[model samples]
Target: MAESIPSDSPAVADDHHGHEEPSFWSKYVFSTDHKMIAMQYMFTGMAMAVIGGFMAYAFRMQLAFPGIEVPGFGIVTPANYNALVTNHGAIMIFWVAMPVLIAAFGNYLIPLMCGCDDMVFPKLNRLSYQIFLLSAVVLLSSFFVEGGGFGGAWTAYPPLSAKAEYSLTPLGSSIWLGAVALEFVAFLLGGINFITTAMNSRAPGMKLYDIPIVIWMIVIASILFLVSVGPLIAGAIMLLFDQQLGTAFFDPARGGDPVLWQHLFWFFGHPEVYVVLLPALGITAEIITVFARKKLFGYKTVLHTTIATGVLSFTVWAHHQFISGVDPRMAHVFTLTTLLISVPIAEMMFVYIATLYGGSIRLTTPMLWGLSFIAEFLIGGVTGIFLGASGADIYFHDTYFVLAHFHYTFFPIAIIGTFAGLTFWFPKMFGRMMNDRLGKIHFWGTIIPFNFIFIPLFVLGMGGQHRRIFDYSYFPELSMPWMQDIRVLATSSLLIMLGFQVVFFYNFIVSLRSGEKASKNPWKSNTLEWTADSPPPHGNWKELPTVYRGPYEYSVPGRDEDYWPQDQPN
Candidate 1:
C-alpha cells in the first residue's frame, strides 16, 4: 500500500504542487513540463520507428523475393526501393533516434537529475517539440505529393537532388528540402534549451563534477549539435537554393561540384553518429555504476575521452568520401583521425568493463541492456576499424559489410540503449514499476534476434553484395546457392526481430496502468532525482536538493547504506 501526504505538506511545496489539475491546454496540448515534453517525443519517435521499420521491411522483401506480390501492399518496384531506402534512413536517424535519445531522454532526465524545476526556458522547449511535430507532418505529407517523397537519398546528394530534371518528382525534392530545414530548426531550439538548462539550472552545490554522467553526455551532445549542425544547415539551404532558385551550389553542369555536397553532408554526418552514441554512453554509465555496486572508475578520464571524441569527430568527416574522388591525401589524414577515435571509445569501454570487476552484479533489465550494449557496440566499433582503413574500405565502402557494421553500432544504441533508459527510468516516468518477468522476456527476445538479423548481413557483405540494390537474385555474382541460402536465413531472422518488438510494446503499455508501485529510490543509487518523490512533482524535488558529492559515490566505506544521494549532508 502507498502512503499519502497532505496537499499542504512541505514535500508538496518543495515539489511545486499547487495545481490540482491542469486545464485542457496545459495538461496535454501544450504542456511545458519537461516530462510531458519527453512523452510527446517518445510517441512521435515510436510512430516514426514504425514508418521506418515498415520501409525497411518493404525493401527487404523486394531484395529477398523480388516481383512477389503481397496482399494489401502492392509490388515493390526499383523506384519504390529507392524511396524506401531514403525514407528509412531519414526517419530512423533524424526522426526516431535523434528525437528519442537526445530530445526525449535529454529533456526529461536532465532537469530531474540536476534538481531543477523546469528547463531554463520552458516555453522554448514546448515550441521546439511543436516545430518537430510540424516537421514530421510536412515530411509524411510529401509521400502523398506529386512523384512522392525525395527518392535520391536522405543525404540528398547533389546533381541527384539539385535538379528537378534529374529527380523523379519536382515537388518531392522541394518538400524534402523544406521538411529537413524545419527539423533542423527544431533541433536548434532543443540544443539551446539543453545547454542552457544544464549550465544554469543545477541545484545548489551541484558543481559540474557532481552532475550525473548522463547529463554530461547530453550537454556534450547538445554542444556537438550546436556547432556541427550549422554547416549542414548552410549546406541544406544551398541545396534548396540550387533546387528552387536556379542557383548552382551542387549542380556541376551549372558550375558546381557534386562531391562538395558529400563533404558538407558528411561533415555533419559522422558527428551525428556520436550524437546518438553519447546518450547511450551516458545511460551505460548510469546503469553500470548502479549494477556494479561501485563507483565509476576513472571518472574524469571518461569525461575527457568523451570531449576528445567530440573534437576528433570533426576531423574525420572525409573518411566517408574516400571513394568519392576527393583528395587522396585527405583520406590518410581522415584514416588516422578515425582510428584515433577508437582509442577514446576503447578507453570508455574499458572503464565500464573495469567497473564491473568483482562487484555485486544484479542482472536487472537495465543492466541487461547495458551489458548487451557493450557486446553489440564492441562488434560494431571493431568492425568500424575495418572500414576506417582506406585499403579495406575500397572493397567494403558500399557493401553490406559497412551496412552490418553501422547497423551493429546503431541497433545497440538506438534499440538496446533506449530500452535500457526506458527500463531504468520507467518507474520515475510513470510512478509504477514495469513487470520484471515481462521485461526479461522483452530483453532476451530482442538481444537474440537482433544478433541473428545483422550477423548474416556481414556474410552477405563478404560475399560481394552491395547495399541499396533492389534484388540480389538478379545478379549472377550474388546468385550462388550459398548466397541464396543465407539471404533466406537473414530474411527470416529479420521477421523474427520484427515480431519480438511486440512483446516490448505489450509490456510498456500494460505496465503503465497495472505494474507495482515504485519506491522513491527504487535502485538505491546516489542520483539527485532518486531523492525526490517517486513520480516527482511538477518542479522535481520536494526541497531543491543541495548536492554534497559526485553522483556515483556507491559503496563508500563509511556510509550506512551502499549508496548515498547527492543531497545528503555529511
Candidate 2:
C-alpha cells in the first residue's frame, strides 16, 4: 500500500511533546486548535446562512405576491423589504460566505495541507473567529434596534447611508457600519495568518509547486484582500464619521464627494469579489481533479492566471460605477479592463475542462457541485460582459439584469462552491462519509432550482424591470401578468431550493453520528490531509510529512493503482 502520513512522524512528535488534552470548553469553545476553530467557523456561518435565507424568502414573497403577508414576518413594509434586501446581501457575503469559504476552510485546510501543525499566529486566529462571531451578532442585533436593520443596501452608499433621515434608521445605519467594520478587521487579521503560514511553514520537501492549488489560491486571496481592503476600511471609517459626527466625508451637501465613496468602496469591492471567488475556484479545482482521477491540467497555468486575475480585478471596479457619472474616457478604460479580466478567468475554465477530458470522471456528489459551478459560473460570467460594456450598462445597471448577474456569479460562488467543498471534505472533517445518495439528491435539487430562479431574471432585466422596490404594481408596462408569472416561478424555485437543503442539513447532522466511518484515505488521493487520521489528530500529523512530488500525481503509466499520493515513496 502507498501510505504516506505517518501516525508517529517526528515533526508531529516534536510539536505535541508534553501537550495536554484540552478540557471541553477549551477544546470546543475557545481552543487554539485549528480543527476545532474550523468547526466554530462552519457552525456560525451555517447559522447566519439560515438568517440570510429567511431574509431572501421574505423579499421573494413580497415580489411574487405583491403586498402579500409573509408567514413568520408580517407584510413586508417597503422599508422592511429594503432592509431584507440590504441585509441579505451583506450577511451572506460578509458573515456567511467569507467565513465559510475563507476563514473556515482556510484555517482548517491550510495548516494541514501546508504540513504545519497550526497557524503561525494561533492566538490571532482565535481572535479572528471571535471578532467574526461578534460581527455577526452585532449585525443580527440591528434587526431589533429602534429603527430596524439599515435599508441602505450592502454598498452603504453615501447620501442615503450618510443620514438616518433619508434611510429612516437612526441607530441601524451606524450599527451596520460598525458591524461591517468589525468584519473587515476580522478578515484582515485572518488574512495575515493565512499568508504567513503558507510562506514560512511548509514541510521540508513541500516546494511552492508542491503546495496544493487550494492553499496557493487561499494565500493569493489573502494577499489580494490585504492590499484591496485598506481603502475600504478607511472609507468605512469616514462613512462612520459622516453618519454619527456629521463630518460629511461622503456628503455632497457638506462639501464631501459621494462619488469618492463609490470609488473607494468599489476599489475594494471589485477585488473582494475575487477574494471569495479565487477560493471557490480553488475548491472546485481540487474536487474536479480528485474525482476525475487525473492530474490537474495546466496547474502552473491556473496559478499564473489566478495572479493575473487578481491584478486585473483592481482595474475593473469602475465598471460598477458606470452610472455614477464617471468621465466617458475613464468608462472606456474600465470597460476594456472589465472585459480583459474575463480572459484569465476563461483561460482557467479551459484548464478545468481540459483536466476532465479523456479522464475517468467520478460524478460524485462533490463532483456534481464542482461541475455545476463551472457551468453556472460560466453562464454568470458570460452575461456580465453585456454589463461590462459601459454603453450597455447605461441600460442594464440597477435593473433585474444586474441582480441576476450577481446572483448567478455569487450564488454559485457562495452556495455551489461551499457545497462542493463541504461534500469533498466531509470525510476528512468528520471521520465519516456523508450519504452519497442524499448528497446527489441535494445537488440536483439545488442546481435546478437555482437556475430556475435566476435564469428568467435575464429576460426580466432586459425587459427593464428595476430591482430594490417593494412593488412594481404602478409600473404597468413592466408589471405585465407574465412578469408576475415569472416572479411566482422564481420565488417558488427558491423555496424548492431551500427545501432541498433540508435533506443536506439532516444528512449532515445524522451522518456526523452514524455515517459510514471513513478510512484514513477514503478517496485514495495524494493530499497530506488525507494521510492524517480520517478526522486527523490534534496536530494533523504524528511527524511532519515530507512531500516527494506534486499534489495531483495520478495515473502514471505502469502504476498499479490509479492514484499517486505526494508522499508515496516509490
**CA shift of 198, model 2, Å:** 0.7
> By lDDT, who's the top model here?
2
lDDT score of residue 100 within candidate 2: 91
> Residues 1-570, candidate 1, lDDT per residue (tens digit)?
012544344212122334567887887878878889998998899899988988877777766677887334579877777888988888888899999999999988988888888886666788899999999999998888878778897878888898878877788888877888898899888889888888877888988888798999999988888888888898999988988898998877768888888888998999999998999999999998998888999789889999999999888889999999988888899899999999999999999899998678999999999999998999999999999999899999989999899999998888788999999999988889988888898888888878877899899998879988887767899978887777777777777878878988898888898888999989988888787787887777557778889998888898689987888896
**Per-residue lDDT over 1-570 for candidate 2, one digit per residue giving the tens place of the 0 to 100 score:** 112444344222123322687788878888878888888998999999999999999999999998888989889998899899999999999988899999999999998888877887776788889999999989989989999989998998979998988998989999999999999999998999899888988877889988899998999999999999999999999998988998988877768999999989999998998999999999999998888989999889999999999889989999999888778789999999999998999999999999998789988899999999999999889999999998899999999999999999999889999999999999999999999999999999999999999988888998999999889998898789998899999999999999999999999998899999999888877888888898987878888788889998888789999888877778
Worst 10 residues of 2 by lDDT: 9-18
Q: How many backbone collisions does model 1 have? A: 1
* lDDT computed for candidate 1: 0.86
- The parts of candidate 2 lying over 4 Å away from their true place are 1-18
